[model samples]
Target chain A: MAHLGLRRFPPPLMVLLFLATAAGKEEYGGGSGGLRFRREGGTFKVLQVADMHFGDGRSTPCEDVLPAQQRGCSDLNTTAFLYRVLRAEDPDLVVFTGDNIYGADSSDAAKSMDAAIAPAIAMKLPWAAVLGNHDQEGTLSRESVMRHLVGMKNSLSGLNPEGIKIDGYGNYNLEVGGVEGTLLANKSVLNLYFLDSGDYSTVWWIPGYGWIKASQQAWFRQTSSDLQKRYTTEEPTQKEPAPGLVYFHIPVPEFGSFTASSFTGVKQEGISSPSINSGFFTTMLESGDVKAAFIGHDHINDFCGKLSGIQLCYDGGFGYHAYGKAGWSWRARVVSVQLEKAESGEWRGVKSIKTWKRLDDQHLTTIDSEVLWNRGSNEPQPI
Target chain B: MAHLGLRRFPPPLMVLLFLATAAGKEEYGGGSGGLRFRREGGTFKVLQVADMHFGDGRSTPCEDVLPAQQRGCSDLNTTAFLYRVLRAEDPDLVVFTGDNIYGADSSDAAKSMDAAIAPAIAMKLPWAAVLGNHDQEGTLSRESVMRHLVGMKNSLSGLNPEGIKIDGYGNYNLEVGGVEGTLLANKSVLNLYFLDSGDYSTVWWIPGYGWIKASQQAWFRQTSSDLQKRYTTEEPTQKEPAPGLVYFHIPVPEFGSFTASSFTGVKQEGISSPSINSGFFTTMLESGDVKAAFIGHDHINDFCGKLSGIQLCYDGGFGYHAYGKAGWSWRARVVSVQLEKAESGEWRGVKSIKTWKRLDDQHLTTIDSEVLWNRGSNEPQPI
Candidate 1:
């Protein structure tokens, strides 16, 4: 559980090499809007807050806290940690990779869920989420949890994908459009997919934790295909599917394939993956557009590893209310997708996808920074 | 590891209904002629011999044998076991799924490999093979082992897929042709795939047993696609891609997703999968052609479970030199693909795929008989 994931190790030096200046964000004018970057200097940043495990509106006691930090420690500490990261990062989008609340600790799941989502709403930032295995244990059903999130302010997550029958709620995709007024503005420069990995086993045969099922996979793949076709139709010059990212709770069993030494960051415990693999990793891999996937559920383990062509990453345990080792700091992951500029200096598509983690420690130190996928990385293409 | 695969559990009852009085395999006069079944009563039977772990000739001491059985046991016992199964099953095809020779135990890997294939050679059956993790631990480079296998009599194993570069050797496919003189004679009614699931980790980033690589997966998908197109072209009225079966040495890590109670077979050991999942299961699922994948690496774990649409199964250990519990008899698996006759009583295509295992005890106990897939099973189609 404590072993870090793959590929983040290569970045400390690379990020230092590219201390590129940044411009403010741009307003992309398209239905696939809500995210954009300037041709000259801007980049789209996404902050992944994993396993917040918020309960009871900042009053619940945090687990795995140091004695000295426990004077007034509670869910407030988790809130404070998130505020610090959000203030420091000012990300274009926030992604909560599940366990938004510790349902068992809360008196009312819906009320506790509001507390969990309050920061993103208060910040007026567009955010999206998928539920963890524990999100349904209290007052509300899993479907209710997702519906509530979708109805929240500035929320981009869908209750489910449109026009398709699939497993689980909150199975949807959001398109991050390119620069405004450009021919590519209609194109989804970056695509993000969110899927609920379910709360528990539904059948006696494939028992253990819930996993992404086949119907959900079929939906994801169809959505991916449609997105790719749309991107190509919008910009015929584009060479591949728009760079995509996936978010889900509960790592697929494939995450356990790596040894402690194989990944970056730290793995403190075994990967608490579902008993059945469900093949989503393969599904995403085949999709070809997905460059990286962010997951939560193994609270103490935060690492990134490149498997096949895609990077399997953990956002690290980002909540004090979640169980983590006392010595490990609660942390959130960040990705900055830099857009490429054309010869005439107009914004093109994604130049690179870079990632790093910021710990909740006093300095708010950025650790495990690395380039996840670059245009020139020669990532595998679909047949 | 003891649990049997998915779909197989329901087969015992269904297979009883079909009782499928199998006809002797037919001689389809086409390039894909090695395997066939007549419209009247034919069925294609394939015997899976896993982890033979043969050493020099017939004089090696077998491990995990009952004391009385050990007194006169040697490699001969394993040879005898194969002969017994072959005689009883009279399979049209014999598939040796890796670990064909115990390189560490053998004085010469090449000579020991000869002994391993002698049964099939003497029996003069059409055979194919893919190597296991232990096959290259001796003198021969993996490439050389496959080269030798390909040059043998009645061998269908390839040095590698022609015209495409990929990871590992012996990646190839064999097509079972339709019955004699039918319009579908050239059509590959039953496609069989064989891939060498490498001997060990070749890269520092992925450690443990060698898993399928991205390049290999790419090749497999391409091959699967090509095969599907050919089948459709050959039989214009066919609704789905032809049924396919893949054979390899090591089980993909997804195999561990099942609980002991979930599968029908006896779980005697843990699934020894590679450190990384190379996306082949998803690839096959996407292909919409593959029905079941047969693998061998974990010597004692014999089970089959369907994931998504394809069934992942292990051929129980068929060699005595391989380690096993004393009472658990070494066994071989059999697949009988029955073909359907047309309304005019001519061969149509594969009607159903059924499987079972035969333990190497007196009476050669037949057990775990089940139908893996049928045209009416409504296995998931490609997205």
Candidate 2:
């Protein structure tokens, strides 16, 4: 059997093996570290496929396929969508925001999951995922799914053996290293927090949604504060803490907090309902580390609005098995952040970040292009 | 034509008329003021009939009536339910937490509203209300509904000429004074904030739920702070700021911010979906005045739990026309706050608060009785 976890191979050997094999992959930012960004100043592109909801080849019908198609089942549709997006955007990293596989029978889940992620695996592209509410609804538990995902080649999922041991799974952070002259030894230029928002409620008698528990909140606060303290030191390039983005399956309650007038894109469906107010959003807002949050449960709703200062956005539907209106077109959100040099001859952090959606039909047309965050040219230097 | 408002009547004359005609009524706390409380230390009972959904007598059918009944419609059922509760509980105050009148037709909404409130009016009982999401679904807007409610015989609704004008309606506060011995003028022993969680979204497309706007949140914070400052003055009986309870139709986003294990009641269905986090709950937590909040929108799902420190509760279902399970026994929540003499021989603020639900089956039985808040004997006096 293939290795089920990163621990099977030692860290140094794994790093050496990854670097040796990653030479031909254009998507891989070839470096000594596990996951690295551009050493020279350039833009880091990320394509997010949210709410894939893929199923076994026979069980789930492909909702987005043409009438004449025969093998338009969930697995086929997911593969085609991923292949299309990969060929079109060629992102440095691909992030799957939960619901990647429709939980069918446990026996077929491994093959189904493999087929769902086959495009990325075949392309030798780096990818990561957080389990969604529906990912564990079938036979396989979330831990089992994590094992499968972590075992895949070029998978960047940091599912620690002893993560949040409560009800959820895969509560880990991934870091992208700064340039060589970025001044900080132990600091990263950007951080990505992936949280498991958990499935249905187990404590309450009535089966409904659950919130991020107190333990997770505590973990988040400690980790976030640690990151902020580590990066906010008086280093020349690090005047402020590095900006981060949070991704999870179910959108936080604050996702519903903004006005529609403030939104820049189409508000198709209203926000999908959330069961409770997990203080995760409040924690991020107070920590000031998270500049934006991207969520995927509400497939039809794709609008980004600023709530209190952080941007809350929805990645438009990317799955064919999920429910959505016809002709609405399945799309994926592409986010790119660029690095620049400051006037003081120091490498500054991400200069600007922009986001847009690419149509997944015959024509790969980009729509709703908007600048989510910009480190202005006239921004003052640290005193 | 009948009077649409009380502005036509002189204030002093109306007061005199109310005082003259308000005799022999058990519900009227007959003192010099408009609505008075018990003089000696005792419990003040409040029966909340939430989500009445009273229609214009014909358009909406009463869903809970017996099969043999002929007048099985919304208006009749609402009136009967109110009359039954009033005759059974004889509560000190009847608080209708929105959705009182289902606006079937704009022209007949006035009569429908009048019929809905006739039971309390005939009993000369003091009452108040907040608008719900469905209250103004027809031609009559929330402003018109508030106007009609304010003009009623014994109404205590504080809807002003110019309220929260941006999105919602009737952002006002009601006061429950302490025993006559408590010191301070223009001060209250307990405050009840009634907010209009507005109807549908005029901003977002697809016609889903809307959130409490920023302006309303600001209003709540300012009003709560002012009340806290006013009540925290150096009075012999008032050692601490007075306690408060907030009532609205749609719950704040923090209502979803709790775990099921943290909940204490029967988790029939999880908390009804809240669209957005308006930061109202955070404001209440920070201001340290609001002890609990009661809401009534999802008719069948009624559960109460502590999010942070504040208690978030539901009033259960009281309307027969609304959608709920068959023969599930519609109910209303009764909240009572008790005042007790402190060591200083002065009447202290609310000593203990209890809640119970009354079922509307063949017999009236109170169930799920729990003490939500209490000033324990060993508790230190507020200095």
Candidate 3:
């Protein structure tokens, strides 16, 4: 009791001291800055980034390889730009939606490419990632590009030690700062069903010993029923009561305009494979309680029409490339939703909303809110 | 132009045949009987089998997850027993050998859990196979497995249409035949090399990429170099005079042991991780008109001692358990080598091995000398 006041330290000084101590440990090195928001009185801000296709080596021109018009940024340059944006915004938490890297031909190149972007990875903020179609290629035959990305050597050596990386192909649930969230969560939230959707083209290529196969759809249906019980109760156990955000790569619910612009004309130039259908998305949307769906793909900044009271939001591509001809440029932004807490400390409903400014403009234009949400209510909303 | 012996055909009979053919056109069905071998003639027979795991799955047992030992034969059973006796008899061309699937964690139950029998794979004449190490766990990552097997799928698939069936892991290759005599005559003799060693234990755990982690030691150093100068002579106009035979699972100089063995003692446990030095085998063995090297993993019946001046006969495992307490058990045999010219005038090598004998007291005594070739020369022979 002699000097309780003497030992007390200021918040900024305490943070600096904690960081200094963490830096001494080899594991904590490099992870210096991250997204952080402090409100004057209890208000906090969070930023969400999805589908940053960094280090995807489709830069060179090849007739049989990438589409001619689509080739622009090399994987290194794109990844470097992504880190630049992360350093600029310095948000509280960055929620990476999916498709972190385009895994296609050369996995080693992709990995070394990832290592070169180590500075961006070291940005210490807590970030969560989910897998996309590009990440699941390993399941088809073993020789898939996804295998290279998820392999132990590549993942460990290529990734920054501090980044909270998650397998895009697996189901995971995480909670940060009392705001519980699930990425590719099991098949249900309030009786609504969800799934990895796999590669929309081939239903047979399930990953991980086929542990997560199409036959598991039955389990998903059952789980969805179980989740509904939690929401039906007057006082839910969790803080967030709003359904849940379903994260995936492709967009759902056919938007004629986007489809026509993105894929329709490509076939005329000799490309025959049709763009995948949104049948899986429609099925998930039919399930109630799936308030929003978040997806990336269809790099153009656009959104689908609201379907069945569900909002679809398409997180724009993280790589630098302008969509259409709007020198407007590419930008990374995060969406934060405030939920109202009930008397019992459980989330009862939506509270307020906040949208962070573009992390940096590398040619990315509009953010597709509908694609990210999957389904939106008829009611009006604000930024 | 030399002469024509013309015979008049009956119009009614010919008309009947045409009508019958037209009627049966819609009734034609597609599918081959899974177990049927058509015969082709040539001197000196050789057998070819790919992806044989000797000590794999069934050798090592895991608690709760696998069945008890002794109740089943591991995938290595048929291949092991057949090779033991096959190697003793010096067959002209024992073409295929590989994948003695033995792993510390592999259990017999895992091998037999599926209806596929290791014996069925070992059925036959003198043969060789490229090694695969599914039996060894942790030694190969899922990514590496896929990369090595699936990466070459397109190239391998283009070789043969009937060979495109996917297994539990979706791995496959090819088997072609030719005559040793014709191989010598055309100066473009049948040259076959068994490639694909499971996962190189040293670099198996790398995180980002698997197969490309480094150039696969087995493929680059061992198998490829095994017949270097013999096929590629110094003179630009003068091509190498002969084709040779090469066989192995994990190529050579890769991860598995090739030079040493634990005949007896407490050190037997350490013998499991054999030093796989493929240099000598690749350099001296199978050069200058050699036919083939029938090989299997060390866990099975591997007769590594060289033969003739060029060919090194390796008849290791034929699918049953490698070596048993009462000597190698299970029965399989390889036919002598046969050579023939293909439509392209290139000599083709073929072996007609079959597995149907029982593991009786008489069969387990000594290895057949007719199929196994003992080394006779000190000079290195380049095939």
lDDT for each candidate structure: 0.76, 0.67, 0.34
Per-candidate DockQ versus the true complex?
Answer: 0.04, 0.02, 0.01
**Order of models, best TM-score first:** 1, 2, 3
Question: B1-383 in candidate 2: lDDT tens per residue?
Answer: 11112122354653454344444223322221243456544557788888877776655677755565436455566677778878888888888998887775324677777877788889988888888877777667778888878778888776632422333677777667665434321245667777787776552311345555444555665666666665564233356666778888887766675676776555556455434344566456645667789998878767777654567888877887776666676788888887766677766577877788888866678887887776643121121
Which CAPRI category fits model 2? incorrect
- What fraction of the real A-B contacts shows up in model 2? 0.02
On residues B253-350, what C-alpha lDDT tens digit does candidate 3 reach at each position?
A: 22233334411111111123223222333222212333344434443333333333433333333444333223433333343433434587654423
Provide the TM-score of chain A alone for each candidate, in the order shown. Answer: 0.89, 0.83, 0.54
Q: List candidate 2 segments past 4 Å from native.
A: A1-33, A64-74, A105-107, A160-167, A181-186, A205-207, A234-237, A344-346, A376-383, B1-383
List model 2 lDDT by residue over A1-383, tens digit each: 11122123454654554454444323323221244456555567788888788877556776745565536455566578789889988887788888888785324677767877888889988888888877876667789987778778788775642532333677667666555434322245677777787776553322356555534554555566666665664233366667777887787777776676888777777665445454566556645667778888888888887765577889977888877666777889988877666686565577777899888778878888888776643121110
User: What local lDDT does model 2 show for residue A54?
Assistant: 80
- The fraction of correct interface contacts reproduced by each prediction comes to 0.02, 0.02, 0.00
Which stretches of candidate 1 lie above 4 Å from their native place?
A1-383, B1-33, B38-40, B381-383
TM-score-wise, the better of 1 and 3 is 1
**Which candidate order results from sorting by lDDT in descending order?**
1, 2, 3
By DockQ rank, best first, the candidates go 1, 2, 3
2 or 3, which is superior by DockQ? Answer: 2
Query: TM-score: which candidate is best?
Result: 1
